[model samples]
Target: MVLEEAYVDNQHNNLENVAHEMDGLLQFNTDRMIFFRNGMQSALETPLDFMILRKAEQEYISKRHEAIWSVALHNRRTLPVYGVSDAFIDKDPTLSRDNTLSGNELMATLELGYLLRLTNNNRGFTERMLYVSRSGFFVSTESANKHHPGAGAL
Candidate 1:
């Protein structure tokens, strides 16, 4: 109701102020708008499928968060990830569009484990970090150790 009244008021005022406000919003978050529009389009295209996929992804994330990793025994372990979507985006927009469409199906599958370390010696795990790619691929650096001068052997 308030929005309708505002629309009417804006219309009466030639929508100059409302247009300016909209311009400000778009300028501030253009990339966010793109993401929002894409999401809306996907939802509209396949509401049920999108909801189911999102629910599955949420469940996976929840399970991961609930999982308890023994840091004492497992200093750094590689956990396999299944069905990871893999694709590369070209820097040139024209070349990318001509070669492949956006949001294409993943070509290959690979098992990549995320390296997790125990920051503190406690029952619960905390202060954990993992390096991941934009497409959610974990980059493990367990074997590769940095050597510093005056550092004792581990």
Candidate 2:
């Protein structure tokens, strides 16, 4: 089912609080699925469906970009953050001029790059896919967990 307006409203109101809570989850190396689920559970009195929870998680990730950047920045021993947009600049001539790009487009592009860098690069990993049904957006965590052990497990 599509997310209720109240739920989305509540999440938006609690964005910063949720982002801070997510830091603790990150410390424990919690899987993204579990982190999102728990984050929603903590934020709202009502339990949301998995699809709604996933959307909430995406929202949280987008809102928490600065927090994510801070963590990555402080951890100097971690993998070097690659210049993902730099590659695109060379490939797409239109993207070569910084003045032509809007602020929103640059931020969105950088966020996409950050997400790609945040994700595991292992060859055999099965990435999560969104399945749209008559019911709504469904991602089968059971199958995902089967492919990647302890993936959806809390």
lDDT of 1: 0.34
Instruction: Please give the RMSD to the true structure for each candidate, in Å.
Output: 20.1, 20.7
Please, what are the lDDT tens digits per residue for candidate 2 over residues 83-103? 222334446554342433323
Q: Worst lDDT window (10 residues) for model 1?
A: 102-111
What lDDT tens digits, residue by residue, belong to model 1 across residues 1-154? 9999998987978778778899987775775456446645654564333443344344334433222211111213222222122223233232222224211211110112221322122223334434443332332223222222321221
Best by TM-score: 2
Which residue pairs show collisions in model 2? none
Instruction: Please state the error at residue 132 of candidate 1 in Å.
Output: 17
Measured by lDDT, the strongest candidate is 2
List of clashing residue pairs for candidate 1: 79-113
